[model samples]
Target: MPTRPLTCTQCQPKLLAYVHNQLADSDRRRVARHLNDCPVCYAAYLAQREVAQELAGTIPSIGLPDSLQLNRMWLAIQSDMNRPRTIPRPQLARMGVACLVFVLALLLPWSLDKQQVALAVPPPPRAPVVTASLNVTASPESGRRALPPTAAASSTEAVIPAAKTPDTPSNVQDTR
Candidate 1:
């Protein structure tokens, strides 16, 4: 069929490479005699052989693992490909700050500080607690006379006008 017959626009592009036998034997005999005389290239070669038999039964293959689950997945990938390789958190914090600066440079000359460290002497000033309150005058016939802290701190001043503050509502009465 080759010597030149093709056309349902060249056998609709050689019907999916002639339904996967990838064409060549002289363009698969001119696309199998133009899919035996073109009913639209034989319904485009039965829709490219039902999409190459639904893509060769849509994939799903991987089945191997049985020898005791392939020897426990090859002993978990050969113990994760033979272990030991850690050290890197910035080289383990620069080897713990170079072993704390080589144990503080070998205890810096036996912790040197030959002189300066005797600061502990503060204990003297404590005397001002002089609380004196006197001018006691409430006297329903002298029922309460008590005012003597050296006569209420050597008394003298006396003009009481208005001093109230327990949130302001006391029976205030020193009208002088």
Candidate 2:
């Protein structure tokens, strides 16, 4: 199991100063020994030093500002940092239009018409013929011509022949 290191809140302010290289040699030595034994303090010291170095680089390196100039600089830095960055509405609208045009470029060919369907003359209707006789047979023994299966259904008729036994001779005998 791992153990948590003791954090000295009182030491943090001096640690910050020490990390920034603004502390005396005696205080630096004390903080260094404390950091060697305490992993939390060591990490905090390293992080604070890195932040101090980054902040020092970001701000101008001029001499300390007098009261009024310092106030104005702090105010300006705060206001500028706090203000939300925005893409203007007109620019967003223009980008939307550009995207629409690009999509249309890809889709225009599919939507446009090149081939037109010509109008064709309709064929004349066929004349109906009359049948004077109707006859149907039901028994397989009947020699009447067999109608196709698609013929209109009648309660007494069947178009298909009955199943034959396996041993029965076929109608056409093979000569081969």
- Best candidate (score: lDDT): 1
In order of listing, the candidates' clash counts read 0, 0
Top candidate (TM-score): 2
What lDDT does candidate 1 reach at residue 2? 20
Which stretch of 10 consecutive residues in model 1 shows the poorest summed lDDT? 114-123
Any residue pairs clashing in model 1, and if so which? none
lDDT of 2 by residue, 1-176 (tens): 53333257656667778876787876777677778987877788889888878887887455656889889999999999999988578988999999999999999866753221111222234444433445554567787667744434334322333233353334522221
Residue pair clashes in candidate 2: none
Model 1 lDDT, residue 45, Cα = 83
